[model samples]
Target: MMSSFMRKSLGQFLATLMVIAALAVTSMPARADALDDARAAGLVGERADGYVALVDSNAPANVKNLVKDINDKRRVAYQKIAAEKGVPVEQIGAITAEKIIREILQPGMYYMDATGAWKTK
Candidate 1:
């Protein structure tokens, strides 16, 4: 029931919103814990080597594709986490790195940095 002008205006507004969303996604930061940092953070450190070995063990094509797919999914997941945490998207990498360390890293492994520290939960 809308007029043509109204529909055109609405379409333009939606296009603008899409452009803005794309820009936001592309401009977001790219820093995240490599698996090592997660271990250092006391998360899953014990299993780090084993995980890597599994990845290196001539994984099937589907497994490799799944890994790539998961890595892409992690970006969106971390973006939501950043928004929820009230941190800039650019800083989400560091925050998530710490989270991985705390949540995933295992104990009794050496993951020291030059600063020689870990934030224990």
Candidate 2:
């Protein structure tokens, strides 16, 4: 028969092993072509998250630099627009970024074009 202390230690070790296995399973990557499969299944949240992950993981140095440049330009543009429209710069940034992301993710045109590209409704 095992000592009481040894039994408790063994139980704790097994519990820890189970918790580690659970965590590993939860964080495992999806199967290959998982993004395509998710899109086919109409899993928008999964697809978007997967796409964002892919872009973040595989983006080149130059593209990452370009995105930073674009964001800097956007900050300047937001400040100018906010000043002209008498709106708070933070509010302008929030609303404009939302609208731009929405338009790109789900296309449509509004009165003011963020990209200056005339998009038809």
Candidate 3:
């Protein structure tokens, strides 16, 4: 017995999940591995807004480039999902963040919390 708002929220979350699944399947393994390596090396982190970010301001240029490239692709995916679901991109981002931080991110990886502070989990 879900309220209308709850039902709508659930529907949007499900749509976001489908988009994320599609992105995971379509993403190149080499690029995904590079992002994984950077996270393991503490060079980059996951933002709360479904984007990859630099962990350190002094991270190497290559790490910065990798984050930028991955984030650009993610933004496009989020926008597409948001439009199809009639939800805000930020909402897509938050749902994606939940899956990433809770499921995808490895133990040593860094992720931003609700307060926008990066934490290792």
Candidate 4:
């Protein structure tokens, strides 16, 4: 039989593990689904120039906020890359956007044109 102290420690460890597993299962899908749903619904689209754009002016508040959050994160990433490479932030953004559009965009998703129009691919 295990000592009382060992049993208590084991229970605590198991509880912590359960919490971590629960979080991992629940948190990841919501973020991915938010973006996927927003794109599918035409609320947001990838731009040819290498940024996200609001496709629908009347999109829901959550979708609009999501776009802003993603764009903000992208800006930070672009800044980091630009500093590392000694290039302009806009240049980094443009290059990254091109690569995302070309390699990461999936079929039947929405994307923006150079003329500021949304198109489905």
Model 4 residue 97 CA deviation (Å) reads: 1.3
Off by over 4 Å in 4: 1-29
Candidate 1 CA-lDDT value? 0.41
Off by over 4 Å in 2: 1-58, 106-121
- Local distance difference test, candidate 3: 0.85
Runs of candidate 1 with Cα error greater than 4 angstroms are 1-58, 83-86, 107-121
Model 2: lDDT equals 0.39
Candidate 2, residue 80: the lDDT equals 59
Candidate 2 has its poorest 10 consecutive residues by lDDT at 44-53
Residue-level lDDT of model 1, residues 38-72, one tens digit each, is 32433322121111112233645544544444345
Q: What would the TM-scores of all predictions be?
A: 0.34, 0.39, 0.89, 0.69
Name the lDDT value of residue 79 in candidate 4.
64
Root-mean-square deviation of Cα positions for candidate 3 versus the true structure, in angstroms: 1.8
* After superposition, candidate 3 runs with Cα above 4 Å error: 1-6
TM-score, candidate number 3: 0.89
- What lDDT tens digits, residue by residue, belong to model 2 across residues 1-121? 9998998656544433433343234332543244323323323111211111113335455444443443454455555555655556565554543433454333222222344333323
In the predicted model 2, the residue pairs found to clash are none
**Which of 1 and 2 is the better model by TM-score?**
2
* TM-score of candidate 1 relative to the true fold: 0.34
